[model samples]
Target chain A: MRTERIGDRGDLHRLAAQGLLYRTGPFVIRLQTRLREVTDTFARIYLGTEVLEDPRLAHFSVRVTASSPLRRPWGAQSQFWIDDIPPFEPYPRTHAFPLLEWGINWCIGTRAHRYLLLHAGALERGGRALLLPAMPGSGKSTLSTALAFRGWRFLSDEFGVILPGAATVAPLPRAIPLKNRSIQVIRDFAPEAVMGPVFEKTRKGDVAHVRPPHDSLARQLENAAPGWIVFPCFRAGGTTAVRTLPRSEAFTRLAQNSFNYRLLGERGFLDLTALVRACACFSLDFSDLDQAVAVIEDLASSA
Target chain B: MSSHESAALTAWRQPTSVRRFTAEQWTDALWGAGQHRCLARLSYRIEDAGCANACPEPAWDLLTSARYYPNFLQVRVAREIRHLHRILRARGIDFVLLKGGAYLSAGFPFARGRGMNDLDLMVRRSALGEAEAALRAAGLVTATLNDYDQHYYRTWMHEIPPLHHPERGVEVDVHHRILPLTSRLNPAPEIMWADAVALPATPGVAILSPPDMLLHTATHLFYDGAILDGFRDLLDIDSLIATHAIAPDYWSRLLGRAASLELGRPLYYALYFARRILATPIPTATMEEAHARFAPGALVRPVMEHLVTRVLPPRPRAARAAPVSAWLLYLRSHWLRMPPGLLARHLGRKGLRRFASDSPAADWPPP
Candidate 1:
């Protein structure tokens, strides 16, 4: 049996070996081993103690404890139990991956106290950022991965942290975790995409992370004005198509998809409305990655 | 005795004001004795007040320990819910309170510990005009809105701008449907009306049934990535599950109810999260049964897991996994509530608008 543990003392070294660490201010995350499973962008994750479990968090801090070495159904084997503990406290004696994704989201969302932390995934090109806001399985990661592979700079695969008083998306170049078939799809589509080892059968099916493109990493400090807001849908057999949406509908959707819109309240509403007002909004449906890529390329070239 | 002294003695002689009679100088003694009972009565009034004292000491202790601004907002909102309920009921516009306020009034002990903001109420959509009128009559007015904004609400949106009571100063959002107007799933108001459970505190005021209540809670959280105060919402789910004795057929009934109303996906998300976090009494086989009716995508499971684990508050080892599990129940409820077609429409409509260029109407996507 393989054990999975979060916040285990030895997990740090293991994560470091996996090249998941990326320093942004005082935070760092253990990038999931399989980066290619999610996106083509270079992504890093910070593993931390689950200090507080509030529903508003992006991820939960969890500790899993296994009685002995256990093998995950997805194929990664572990020998640890995971136990979640309060944030800032010492790691408990559990032997599981002490995840810090949601905990970090809460920290940034609340503690950052300056910028509004959004839930949409963001990518940039030519100093222009496009936010891909959708519910899970909307092919957001797949689209973001495809775009990054095609030379678009990866701002973030998970969050679009809009800086205060600016319309630009501050780059938080983190690993995008792709799941199940998305892993194989991205691998076949972007052959040169550098991906970490796959962690199987833990949760969310077999999961992998994709490294952000080097260009995106290089421009991590840069901020890009939001130029486009597209909601991508991956229909199994649908033909590729892009349709424009109305501002009112877009405003509602963005607000709904937004992580901090309500927190931003009037400001969130104003900023999001202005963003949609200024940007070209669209709905893209594609069964083929190449077709979707082509459409985005065309859209970018035209913009 | 002189008139002034006589009046003072008379005032002091009242039994309610004479509890602390052994004070200093006569004037000081009178004031202290008179004020002590008033202060005590005020304290007693606050203690006996609706839902204000509903929170447990530990939760209050935890909240005060944190100097975070949002924490203050959380407690203030909880207190406001108690106050808002009293005022709304006094006006005779019966309300089926949703989420935090409902849970607190449902005899759930943990309601006090749960974090919440913005009181949610469900009123008949037909009565929207009357409801708005009543709210205004009771001093709760809509937030400021420009002409275009008012048109948008009246024309496009499902509900009006959140209402704020002048006296209570708490924002209250009166909702008809869980999702926006464009969403495909529209659970019939009659079903909500049928399953409407009366509040224990106020007989005239009723709430959505347990399943419906869970469904609504999930829809609210999953449809929009609840960013601002999601932690509080998660806690509400935890408390609801911990207190309610949800039946085995609850999932099926919820799914059936959602299907009847066309709210599939929203219910699925709700049930999925409720089960994952709170580990609410939902049987796995039942969950599978429910999922068969409203099959979620492969991506949803992992995302659900990620979300449940992510949002659940950190607790000690002895703390039950009920909160995480309860979230899954709501996820199931959300899935059943909003089917794929509706999810697609919502996504499509939203995408077109956000990505549309200057030619708004010309570029509008077909629903």
Candidate 2:
């Protein structure tokens, strides 16, 4: 069967208003919106994603729209709704696309307990996954985007979606959001990267999105087993350093970084423990994006 | 509302019927149950009915993920109760578990996936002061500190303002009665206390008798609960009857208890809708007797049926508000809760506050 990819911006608008279901790894996200910012950016970023024609189960049916049906010209705000329930306050109207991205991520972090959702950036090579689990502002997204340009299949820049029992991860390669300084840093790092309009003064400061390589988005369903876990940190004007981590420490850190570790209870513990035990672990700190990418690539090859 | 999902909601009581559902229909089942906050319970039914394989992989993933939520709630309830138990035990006071907490403590199998946002327990009115002091000393903050809220809970409401456990994020509601004291129908708490059943597993904890439990469920559904969105409460009534009404004498006992408690009206509504909507097995004799004894007057019956049936079925996503009937039912619930004069003053104050803040959707939108 031929897969139906999204067409032009006008075509995207119609499908979204009528409710468009698109596959992103294990999730069938039903997205509906009239906000041009959302539809416009979504069309550009999701070029290779499969849009399901049949009306079926969607993990979330979300709509991005103005707070009120009647728009305010001077200071309009856009809200994100799952079904009819708006989970958060609205953002500035100009920030609709970013709000849509964050809104869907919120749905996954809060509800998708079918997998062990690690708060990490993941990329695959030779059917083996390298996990870059880190806290926010630690250069996880920047490094993952850099790696994708360097021939690694991007799994996700926000989530390491590990299916329990099989201990394998399916791809969740949504757009990689580059915040603050990471924006210019990625442009310099990957000159040919496809980028979206940057919204000024978001909660996380100036933000833009870089679509993952077309190759990664095309092979989103290919699953990979955990082969390495690297906790990365970025510090300006500092030298590169790498240190191996013990299994026990890795297990604790990974669990702490999970979105639903406690909610999954015993099952989460077992999945995390098995993942840590099966993979080699390390912590890498680098001042340079190029150096950080090189160290990760070396680790990927050695593993 | 006439979509496949709305149609799927009609078969919610029969899990075996899931076998006939296509992948799309299973998706519909998930949305309705999720909207009602009954996903975990439906998951159990799917498994129990031996129809797990019939559920599509997509729907099954969500149902499986939903398991951890109620499981998390069960754990939180147990921890919070343990904290309360130690404090109240030091004061030589016992609390009667109500609703979700009661079902959980009693080990009811159907309660496995039930979600409880707050802990509900009842104590004698005299012990209210002592219970408040103990909880404060235990470091559970009183979330309702504003003068109006405090007055509302202390002076007239059935439960005092909720006490928040800062660590677990669970609030506790300590009740002296099932309905507001100022409400039109105030069942005697001492009478319920006389028949509370003690649990050996958790000493000093007891649940309402089965008959009282049914009536309480009915009253809570129609009288106190948020109107137009009591599908879960209806499911509770069905589950309660299925579990406890096995004995031949249960119906007679339930109806008799409703009379003694002056709760016949709520019970009539409960049984009427439970039968019509879910096809719950109510003995024909009980239905006839209930209608004769407690059915609403002719004028009110059609109005209530019109409003309730419209609201109970899940509305399609496009319709934002319930018909004007919603505001009417909401106002009716308040009217049922307190005398008209007091309700007028209270709603007047609240209406002004809503106008002030520009209602951000809601602080609580159903479940």
Candidate 3:
């Protein structure tokens, strides 16, 4: 099922240009593209990721193809497709990397109903998983990436995927995308980490992707048990504090933030109830990344 | 036809045909079945054949997930029906469920994990206004449509514009008749209501009786000319026949119902395509009798056979003839519903509107 990353740059571009099969945490994706921007960015970010040997069964297939030349005179545009159907409109030709990233996320969130998917950033410590679920402007992504760089094994900075009724969370780590002000915060906070180029004026303001730790991809298949659930809210100049949340409140908030909670029905409810009941739930309000990590570190070690 | 594309149908028709599928074969089957919107049905057949556990990773996950989803929606659909049932019953209005909702509530095994776009119900034409008012009062919101569309539906179409229950996220299509009022044939609603049966569990909620159910499925499939979803519609017809075949005199009752309602043409096409495409079982006598009574003229029969043969396969990719078939089918459907002058006027207006393209893709964070 595995082979070393498809040789060097030429081979990578050649295969992906036609079409190539790559494994992404339990699901196999077949990507086809010819654009240099897409191929180059994909190579850099996915260097640690494996491209599968032949005899493949892909859960979803994507093709990032250029849109009509005339549609955008000043800048070329590219559209994302699964099979032959376009799920979203075209993105700037330069911004194809994040388009690919979030396109895969959309497919997983929409189609992968086998697991309960929480809209949370997940990291693992001491064989247990930490989930940071929050609504927009909650500083979850910035905080999760901060934790990952500080020796917490990264699972994902997006989907916290748990198999229904299982105690462990599956690893689906990818490049953590830091948007707007969080981009600069992460750059200053984690100077040692590898980062990708930032594309300006994306739908969500400026965006850049931080390559996950090498160990995260190496142990992508590993699963961790439930340890903590933290809902992080970033408030500039505010004090860093962690308050315990009742399991019931955690379940409700988690479901509201979940990608497919309603779609999974009873199984989602049961699986989530079990996870929340087994874990320590908290709402963290922090302005300083260092203090936030410290508090979460204490909770992780306690579990 | 590609051998890969045939895997799902062959497996569905004969579950034991292939016990294990190679990765490539699985990809082909997945693509084919997905195009038909029969992934859940395919999954059920695989599980029933006892091969689901033996299947490789991701394949099993994909199947179980697709199948489980409809069951989840099934719960929501039932709740929505109950909500609608109470609303209409309190206002002393009687209604019967139309398609998926009826099939689900009527205890048909084929409907177990079937995914549907919207829940459909039909109230008496006399009570349409009152039912609409009661539904609006009950907090079912209809999306804002333009004044022209509002007039078009209320004046010409059999159904009002769809109503969405904001809380449950379910769309309800309240239809007053089986076909459009302007259609070539208006199957009497009173004849249908005579045989409606209250769901055993939901006393006030009702579904069409078996013969009428078969007739409705046939009429909706052929007259609606839903060629894009034709493959799944064929599966529904096949399953309905298979389920009802167990009952004594079922085929004759269905034929008699179609004849009395002047809907024999659609019933004949439904049986013809179901048998040809899905290999649905139809008694020899029944097929012969239907052909004699309702089959099209000699010239048109072969033409239709050519088109449906092209349109109804779950082809891995659409064949060259697909668009031609779909175009003809689209026109046929409109012609079946409206007189020629009205049809032309309606199509011209709708075509003009397409000069302005469809709404843009939804913003991210939602998808």
**Highest lDDT, which number?**
2
Docking class of 1: incorrect
lDDT of 2 by residue, B204-287 (tens): 889999999989989998998555678878888999999999977899999998998899999999999889777899999999
Task: List the lowest-lDDT window of 10 residues for candidate 2 chain B.
Answer: B1-10
Every candidate's lDDT: 0.56, 0.85, 0.83
Against the true structure, what is each candidate's TM-score?
A: 0.41, 0.93, 0.93
lDDT for position A49 in model 1:
23
- Over A97-208, each residue of candidate 3 has an lDDT whose tens digit, in order, gives 8898989999999889998999999999879899999887799889889988898998988888998785979989887888989988988999987878888998888988
Please give the lDDT score at residue B170 for candidate 3.
88
Model 1 Cα RMSD, Å? 23.4
How does candidate 3 fare on TM-score?
Answer: 0.93
Give stretches of model 2 more than 4 Å off. Answer: A7-10, A34-40, A66-70, A75-77, A301-303, B1-5, B22-27, B316-321, B352-367
DockQ: which candidate is best?
A: 2
**Which regions of candidate 1 are displaced past 4 Å?**
A1-22, A25-114, B1-367
Residue range A1-303, candidate 1, lDDT tens digits: 433323445444444334333444223332333323121222233233221211111111122222222433343322221112244432221212323333445445544433555567788877888888888788888888888888788877667777655476788775677888999999999998877667676346667777677676556777889888787888999899898888788778877886666655455666776777778888788889999888988887785
